[model samples]
Target: MKKLSVFFALLFLAFVSLPAHAGEIPIGIYGTLTGTDTDVNGMSYGPKDYLTYVNERAGGVMGHKYVPILLDGKNSIPEEVKVFKRLVEVEKVVLVNGWSTGGTKALRDQINTLIKIPFQAQSLSSDVLDPQKYPFIFLLGPTYEDQVLIALNYAKQKGAKTFAFIHADIEYGRAPVRNALEQKIPEKLGLKVLADIEYAGGSPDLTPQLLRVKELNPDYVYIQDSAGNTVKILRDAAKVGVPAGKFFGNNYNFQHIIPGTLGKDAEGFKALQINADWGENIPMMKEIEEFGRKQKIEKKDAYYTKGWVQGKVIHELISRVLKKTGGKIPEIGQFRIMLKDEWVKLENFDTGGGTPALFYKDHQGHTQARIVEVKAGKFATISDWIKTR
Candidate 1:
């Protein structure tokens, strides 16, 4: 959407008609795609659907075909950084979107902050929302901390007293550990955390952690790791007889850490909170879903839904300002100002009808969340909705 930039500029300039631009405009989409495994990185097909839908019918935003340049970070940070720089400087792209939290963080840190280009993390994390840290980075979902806190409370209400924290001993693992522990008992709900143990991110065997957990026998288990190690933990958890308590897992990082290894064993495991499908009910979801179906594509994971939402929402904001700017972006600074203006107006806005939102202003502007669990080889919601975000 370079055309979107032109469109926003037009809006600022009080010109209604779209201005013509030469050649195809490049929009950066940085995420993992074309992998056998799904859900970790957004499906490339989903973007294809979104682009195709808008292009085929809407004629794309402001007459540009929405050419998304793929920079498959492949869940690698360095690669993500390299691609991000290439997208902004070499390619002269107006915006960037992609997969991988590590990649998002890498771009945020590596890029020149003063450049002030808007960035959104398709991954479901609030780390990027810190106004102090990555001011330009926008999150599209509730913080995992809020999600777990809601879960902790829910567990307490469901007679959960002791929680076992089984997480990969890494940054993602540590953040949740802090959130789960910092809270006091909420009124009548008796929630107590028993053990907070760390498992290797890719550990082949999780016997040590499982055995340690079994000795304590917690009332609930909250896992904060992904990849093959997560599967090993699930399998070994079953093998070691760690009491049939409520189990919470991370978003199946698509490494089959859960579905591949845990197989049916992960059924009913209440891990993270999210919506079921993007298209079955919601308008935005419908837009992407129908687009995918028409284009002969399928986007299984809600993460991709969130990513596409990021694109649409960001574009919507850009369109808002660009309408005023006479379809031309004066500089990166002005673009940042336009985003800040749009965000301030939507400070209280919530996408309540569908999908859990990325929110947090203090910690993050979290919108809402619903807890989902795996049932019979597919994910199912445990509660109708949990609005912790």
Candidate 2:
């Protein structure tokens, strides 16, 4: 009887040593689901839908389903901070996917130092790429500065000398423009800055700003704003006699639905294409389409693809770790270490045609951009995937 008791005690000890939450992986998502600057709603939805599909079809990563605690900050910094803290402390999520430049920056130190959870931000802010300062923060693609640099390079190739930089008076809009106008354009590309314009985001009228841009007669105009304001800017620019063909925008401006939404106003609008176009005959696109068909989701935009790609990365890393551990989820530190050590080694990661290739050695997944121009009511690839300095 004593020997039997000893054997049962050993078995209980082994069972207790196993992970408490073995069958469920808890992750967190923070984005602006309902806000004025909520153009990326579809983007957030893409990942959510993909993860749902994974849970439904493939039984999730290594037979463990993801329990995503999603929160909306409504594009407010204070609100984002509150939500982020709750996600880390209360929810006890091991990983989080965040959005908004302001919120990401605000939570950088806490998430990196205190919480120590691996985080991927949708913000392409250059500050987020500094692995030394933000060891926990990972970006999906090229920094916003790189996007601006690509724009400058394309404009230079097309013989555009003087340029007008227009962006919202927000951190997301200001950071890249500052990098371009104050540093990269002059130091590297040797381009002339004609005007630095700013306008209220989602403003009904940008005629005053476009008039100022027209006064300078800039050879090219670089805009950093959301899709809605982008259309407004283009329309007002046309009315103010700033040719739409001379305009260029950032990655956020290049949604697949813009042309159909803006009709002729979106003509000649060129922006950096970080991912493959939606209708492109790519394997990822086909997969997304089939997934959408089954889910009855009709609007799969660029933002959606972006979100899906982010989810894919998370799924890949977790699946890899689980496979290596014989279906055991690693501890939080182990998970973070594996992501930093093993996942960053991924070469030319398949981002479902959303990006060319993703390798996060220094935490910047993409370093190139493809320029796409609005022609005949649709985005047309105008240049190859050009490398950024």
Judging by TM-score against the true structure, name the best candidate. Answer: 2
- Residues 179-298, candidate 1, lDDT per residue (tens digit)? 456654322356666777986565678888889988888777877755445567767878887632357765443232365457667666666645435434766766665666556544
Candidate 1 whole-model C-alpha lDDT, 0 to 1: 0.60
Off by over 4 Å in 2: 1-21, 296-298
**TM-score of each candidate structure, all chains considered together:** 0.78, 0.90
Residue 227, candidate 1: Cα error in Å is 7.2
Candidate 2 lDDT over 86-203, as tens digits, reads 8878887778888888889888888778767788898998967787888878887778888877777777888877777899888888877886656656447667887789888767
Instruction: Assess each prediction's global lDDT (C-alpha) against the native.
Output: 0.60, 0.79
